[model samples]
Target chain A: MAELVKVVVDAMGGDLAPVEPVKAAVEAVKERKDILVILTGQEEVIHSELKKYQDYPTDRIQVVNATEVIETAEPPVFAIRKKKDSSIVVGLKMVKEQKADAFVSSGSTGAVLVGGQVLVGRSKGVERPPLAPLIPTAKGVSLLIDCGANVDARPSHLVQFAKMGSIYMEHVVGIKNPRVAIVNNGAEEEKGNALVKETFPLLKEAEGINFIGSIEARDIPAGYADVIVCEAFVGNVILKLYEGVSSELIHKIKDGMMSTLKSKIGALLVKPALKQTLKSFDATEYGGAPLLGLKGLVVKTHGSAKAIEIKHAIFQCVQFKQQRINEKIAEKIQPAQFPAPDKE
Target chain B: MAELVKVVVDAMGGDLAPVEPVKAAVEAVKERKDILVILTGQEEVIHSELKKYQDYPTDRIQVVNATEVIETAEPPVFAIRKKKDSSIVVGLKMVKEQKADAFVSSGSTGAVLVGGQVLVGRSKGVERPPLAPLIPTAKGVSLLIDCGANVDARPSHLVQFAKMGSIYMEHVVGIKNPRVAIVNNGAEEEKGNALVKETFPLLKEAEGINFIGSIEARDIPAGYADVIVCEAFVGNVILKLYEGVSSELIHKIKDGMMSTLKSKIGALLVKPALKQTLKSFDATEYGGAPLLGLKGLVVKTHGSAKAIEIKHAIFQCVQFKQQRINEKIAEKIQPAQFPAPDKE
Candidate 1:
């Protein structure tokens, strides 16, 4: 029999957690019998939430018993240190001990980042574990690395991000030879600050990846590049703005359709088709961002996430585990991909 | 006699420059007699482009004769240093010497930031001169500060930004007690990175401005905040993404409308209304991003700008000059606005 892909989840993490998480966990286990979920939270609170799902396999949905929750207000380092029994820390410990294949959290992002580092550990030869987020685009989804991991990063780090992110997209997400581009003020090679200027040539010279010169902010939604690499500061801003504007646009479109009587009538006539088309704009479909380049996987879902978001996050882990994304990165970095220096 | 509001135009700057700049200068002079536009560029090129505008005031549109043009490829610091007679440099000099009230360019943005610093200088007590770009929102417009001025900035700089941007929005854009917020990953003050955490208290303690706490990106288009404060790198990204996604959505909507005969008929029925609404989404209406907190006014228009964009930029300067935004900013920074030691 194939080994079960046990995933540890911080059930007490998010705003609507325990409830949404329990629903998602039950659904995930129902869909995939080969999967097992270890929900970590206050035993009483989690049990009460999980009681709604009577059909969930008791053995498959075991509780690790985390007593405390990390408040979003606490300093990340302080929270990670003090809240040892917090869901995030406990779930990470499960991954650390190989009790689970991955750890999923819809919790305080700061704690997740800290817990991932302290418990799961960074991958071999990895300078930083970037938060590689899969952003939905017109063409498909592009993996945006360093979305909010390391704020102050170097050029060499960005090069590593490009390579590692390319590995994730190519193997796990199933994109081949992911086109990587450095985010810049302009599309021109010399159009950004010192970091972008330095990273440009390095990314251009990188092998086993399709290095596109540069991409301006406007090209992102159109899916101009498959792997958009940038420092955490830039990546964080882009990801947030991307989420903001897309949501705003959808909200406006909906509002516009509902404002007038005639428009409302028109909206009703086109409701089904419009909803289907606009559903493509939903960022939740892409799942949570992965804290990539870690020994054990950690996925950080949105704090305001619902049951659907949790379900998608679980699905993402399955794909991530099946693809052997890390091993692929090691293989890509082999001396074979790099040419011998003329053998003179 | 009223003193002429002299405007300096970098005629050799922008993609459609010479032609667009000359036409915009002519149109502006016609609109306001107290305005004098000094067209700086290669004399021959200026004359050739100027010939297209037959009704342009030949005497008012004086060609300042710049010998060289700063290519976008050149490093900002090096280009500003070496190209003494470049259009960007000449334009800056015109404003610095009080020959013009404002300097407008659709040229290299980095060069503009460099030239504004090297030429126009900074306002007294101003530690940083933030680039405040006016972005169109559903509720009129918003001022996004530090878009590309200082890449790595401090929490104190953001506090200054909130004051300056609020002043501009109130005095120039005619919004009172303009809601100012620090852009962050989450709406809660406790969320976001170190910079955001540091800035949150300062913003709250800041007086003379309506300091709304952290605002997520998705809230921007629905017009959540009047002034959005962030470091240049983050601000630049948000601005660019807003531009990009809006363009993408417009294209997608247009394409979708043309996909079927029924949809095309639907589009035709709503063509006038849709055109009116979409026109408001045009980037040109807001004109250029002003390098605020400078001793003299400096504006950076889009590089790919045309005559209409130039015309709008010139009008934006008119409002900036007339509104006396700097005086308001100085008032906003009074001792009373700073938090008392006890509060800290």
Candidate 2:
């Protein structure tokens, strides 16, 4: 067997907490012999959950005691600093000390982001570590970078996003020469806010990436680009609005189907095919968002994540380790690759 | 009949050009005896299309010749300045001269915005005129202000947006003490970009408006706020992404319904009820985006608008005139209603 990829799972994080994370860790180990999980949380709670599972390799999943929990409402930087034995902080520290290859958490997004940066640290020469999530599009999934990581981002930050996003899509998502585009109000080159207008030309001149021009939000769901780049503010709105509109639309459609007896019968006939079709667009199936450019892989799943998403997030870390995404990011984001820093 | 509300129809605009605009003007005059339309375009083309509709009241619809046309690709400021005899310019001039109560167009968005500001002009103390469109929501429609008008907006500008948006929603849409919220990444007051962070306190303190705190994009489609306020860049993304996702999902559902023979039969049964249910959520049914704070109303319909949308936009002007929305805005946005200007 190949060398095992050690991934630290935050068992006390997210809405489902120890039960779902422990379940997922057990399932992941049973499915893949090339990976092991360090389940971090309260020792007794994790052990109690683990008892429900049987016939798993005893040594593959280990429980690491963590006495503290970082609530989602806590200030991220303060929590990371104060809650030293918290599951999120402990997991990240393990990665920082080189005891684990990756850290996966569905805990407080802010805490995870701070811990990922302050604990695991940024890869050398990487200016900002972005959270890039694979959002489902009509053609396939497209990577939306900087969704909630950095707001008020400058032109230089966006250019780096394009570069890093291209690397992630090409290696992990397996898209060859992924087309990168900046989100703008209009398709025209001159049409954007101040930041987008400044970044458009830089993206066009950037090296080692397939740089497509500006993409309007109307073209996003049509899968017009492989990697969508923007500041965290616009990117967050796009991500959440996509969720809002889809759920609202689905609810409306179901209401329509149930309004009449004829359509009610039709609903039964159409339910299976529609469900299968929509399954391809389910975001959880794609796993967690990776805080790219970190020294060690750090994945942040939804706070409300279930067992399947946690399992997928763990599996995702395995691929990130196997493909050596960090090394590639470090090589691509070297100081020599970028222009001189902008003067304030 | 009541005093006639004269509206200038831009006959030489949009994808459908004189055809749809002329038909809509004739239809408008037929449906409402208290309105007159001044059709501005190349005299021959306007007359030619007008000749096709013989049953309309001749005196209620008059053609005013405009020799030039402004294409959508032209730079807005330059086109508004140089295109002296363009239909957009002539129609806007008519509103400036008080020859019409409103000007409605399916032409270039840029030209309409520039012309609305330069020719029709802003009301006293109105810092920036925002383009406010009523987007369909789960409950009803909500006004999304500054959708494409202002970028890199300041805190003062957003405060004005809140004031103007609240006025428009209350007077036009009939929403009383409408809940106003700034678009933010999170629900917390402290959670926002620089612009939103600065504007949040000002909005809460601003008088003459119901100020709710920050709203995430996820809550927008659920009708969480009656007036959704943001800078143009974020607002544009939300508006366009809403369009993109809904269209794509509708397309996917249709594809799924035809994937199997059983579903094809089921689709036929579900078609009528689904269509009826979806129509309420149709954006075009809500009419055009009004360039608020202008001396005379200017409504911009979609470039690809058909007769129904054109008719709705025209009727929307009637309501604006009847409700005196512009007068109400001027009163609400007086200098006394705002704080002192920020130092540069």
Candidate 2 ranges with C-alpha deviation above 4 Å: A336-344, B336-344
| Each candidate: chain B TM-score | 0.93, 0.96
**DockQ, model 2, C-alpha based:** 0.82
lDDT of 2 by residue, B183-238 (tens): 99999877899999999998988888898898889899999999999999998999
In Å, residue B270's CA in model 1 sits off its true spot by 3.4
Top candidate by lDDT? 2
The CAPRI class of candidate 2 is high
**Least accurate 10 contiguous residues by lDDT in model 2 chain B:** B334-343
What is the overall TM-score of model 1 with all chains considered together? 0.83
Q: Give the Å shift of residue B111 in candidate 2.
A: 1.2
Candidate that scores best on TM-score? 2
Q: How does each model score on lDDT? A: 0.80, 0.90
